[model samples]
Target chain A: MSVVELARPIEKARATPKGPRRRVTAWHRWLSPLALLVVWQIASATGLLPERLLAAPADIASTAVELTQAGTLPTAIGVSLQRVLIGFLVGGTAGIVLALVAGLSRAGENAVDPIMQALRALPFFGLIPLFILWFGIGEEPKILLVALAVSFPLYLNTFSGIRGVDGKLAEVATTLKLSRGQLIRHIVLPGALPQTLVGLRQALGVAWLALIVAEQVNATTGLGYMINDAREFLRTDVIVVGLLVYSALGLATDAIVRLLERRALAWRRGFLA
Target chain B: MATRLSGVARAFGDRVVLDSLDLVLGDGEFTALLGRSGSGKSTLLRALAGLDHEVTGTIDVTGSVAVAFQEPRLVPWKRLLANITLGLDAPVTKAKEALAEVGLAERADAWPLTLSGGEAQRASLARALVREPELLLLDEPFSALDALTRITVHQLVLELWARHRPAVLLVTHDVDEALLLADRVLVLDEGRIAHDVSITAGRPRHREDPELVALRTTLLAALGVSPEGRS
Candidate 1:
């Protein structure tokens, strides 16, 4: 009520300088990577590290530029990106559909969950030989491998997310007389989204890893194939460039998912943004 | 009567939660239920809300029913406004109006997790009353709030119930809260109504009023808490 009381809050606000501190923290994030790059450049310049074993950061950068100019990098990247996109679509949809069927009913869960769990325990990449035998060395096995890798995390997370919805909230639905469809659309799906996003982030990581492995095994194109071909020529710089491309793509996909999370979960004020 | 339950019996694994409960809640009447823990108060409320369906009962409610639980079960993922009108055909404008009615118009876009306990409970009340139900069941909706917030919510509920005129069944363990809010107070014991007292006290009745004090003493005795050591 008093002016002094109001002025005290303003005084406190003036005392706390938040903006500069936040900007400093943002800048600090890149400090470690830059340090690592500087170390690598120093080691290469001093000739302490042999060029044949590992490419210098500068050489990798210039080689990336060269590969881009030659169109090899861009074409390989485009192919790899398309494979991940399709694999994600196929795997993500199946995971959601199976999660819904299992999460909603005990009968569906009983019929589906154990088999999924059994399959989930088997390292999917180990089936590459079987896949090659069955589908032959083509895009089919590679895409399927990526899809298989992406599915399990999503299925598990989505299933748990739906199961973890508050029973009290569901009781609210009962009182509202929400139809079955309304219940799923409004309550179940949104409640499951937080966990589903966790699964999505994990699936994104696996999808990229799967694509790298699938392309490495029997591929004429993509970053994996480029890295493999450079290995024969002992072109460490080109291999490093290929690996960097994969890492950048992985980071990009994860960043996209993070953007989706922020948009979908704006209602949540999590401790970490 | 807006709600009726006859020969209603519910059990869980041979443990009887409600035994042959028979009651009728009058239209637009505010009724409070008081009981000890494990006295089947929640079982009865859940039955009325149709949340407990395994019960054998002839239950009839005149129209739609809404319930607000003790924990203010607003979905964490929805903003307060969306939580109020979730799964209902109501528009955002109606949700905003409901929030305003509960003195939370400024919190329409706020997340449920950001709300204080009292604010969340208010949002819960708004969520229920927005449905314009014929019956509104409250399961200790204010028990989690501090004393000051509880009194504010008591007044808010009174005002809302007065305007809406829904048949309200409030389940609480607070004797004073029951005496203050309800036109009729029912005490449950041993899976049935043990005391059904019609409160004759007028609106804005003082807690210190002899009639309320006497009724409070009676209700406390029914709850098996001795009233002998008080001032």
Candidate 2:
């Protein structure tokens, strides 16, 4: 209430609008990538290294266009995306079931959790060899590898989400005399969905990364395979083109999830926004 | 037995919050729980609402029992109408009716976050009302509101209570609040019913009337605060 106390906060509020303008100088957000591209082009023109070692941005763009015309680009991307989708679904469902079991029953945690934790600790990429041996180097192994890569994120998030749900809300549910199933459907699921969504997005990202690794080895036609094949022929242009497609796909998928999250959480807008 | 809790003794570790407190909320009586902080008023409401399991009591009630938490814990994800309708298995036309009672029918579609504190509390009241509860447990229902807001809400609550007339148990720290509302005010001090004061004041009773003033003095005295200069 004193003038000194009042003045400081008032001054800060007045000054705060200027802070972002100063901090986020226009080029900081939009121009850094364009600058990097310029440097890349300049380096290619300098020719200190062979053209194979460093593909110019223009060369990658041209290769991308050629691949698009041939129809290989979209097909590779589609196959990779489909595999990620199926694998994420398989793994995500099982993770949710396990999270619920562990959340509801203490015995389930004691009995099943240690093994799950141990499996979670084992590098999913390392499991590729075991999967290859068991299911053979084919689509099944690749799909399983994608699933294996994704499962931990889903399980961890789902489990923590269940654990982290407001006990106060659960008490509210109980006071209403809701049945167990009703409690799960109305209160528990919605309560956990926010965090579970975070897990789902994270799993999708990991799955996309894993799909690349899975497809790179063996009789596969995917962006990953294209990159690996390009590597053998030393076609840096194609490799750069594949990396761009991979990164773009990952970015686009995450953007979609972000949009869904925003829409799903609309009711929370009044409080959190 | 419409609503009953017998031989109820609730303790938290070494602290006995409610001990051997046998209570029976009659079929249609409004009972106000008055107590100081740590007097286990909220605890008793929680027990009756069946949210607390630590209590050793048999709470028997006819139909559903709905509670309005002290903080108006409206489901943040639900729209105002949806939050009210959440507990009803039988579609309640009364959801809008309840919202109207709380003067929030206009805000039926608004997210709870957009609500003022009073509005949020009103929405919570709507939620309990929609359940058509046989017993309604209110824990410090108006304690969080400003004095002006509290008065308005109190009038609204009294009107709604008149309509529904569920066996109501309201808890509050404010002595005057307990006095203004209930047919009978029960004061708890350290887990026991230290004083049970019956306010024989009629509805729309004037606060400055000699009898009601005397009764207020009596409650203040019972709480060990002398009504000397205050009166």
Against the true structure, whose DockQ is highest?
A: 2
Candidate 1, which segments miss by more than 4 Å at Cα?
A: A1-36, A270-273, B90-95
RMSD of each: 5.9, 4.9
Q: How high is the lDDT of residue A207 in model 2?
A: 84
TM-score of chain B in each prediction:
0.97, 0.93
Q: Write the per-residue lDDT of candidate 1 for residues A1-48, one digit (tens) a residue.
A: 233533335324433547886567568789999999999999998998
For model 2, residues A127-213, the per-residue Cα lDDT tens digits are 777888898976788788888777778888887887787888888878777788877887887888888889989988998888888
- Give TM-score, chain B, model 2: 0.93
Would candidate 2 be rated incorrect, acceptable, medium or high by CAPRI criteria?
Answer: medium
The digit string of per-residue lDDT tens for model 1 on B1-231 reads 568889899988978878998999999999999999988999999888888879897998899898999999888877888888887787888888899999999988888888999999999999999999899999999899999999999999999999999999999999999999999999998788899999998988799989899999999999998899665
lDDT of 1: 0.90
- In the predicted model 2, the residue pairs found to clash are none
For every model in order, what is the number of clashing pairs? Answer: 0, 0
**CA lDDT of every candidate:** 0.90, 0.81
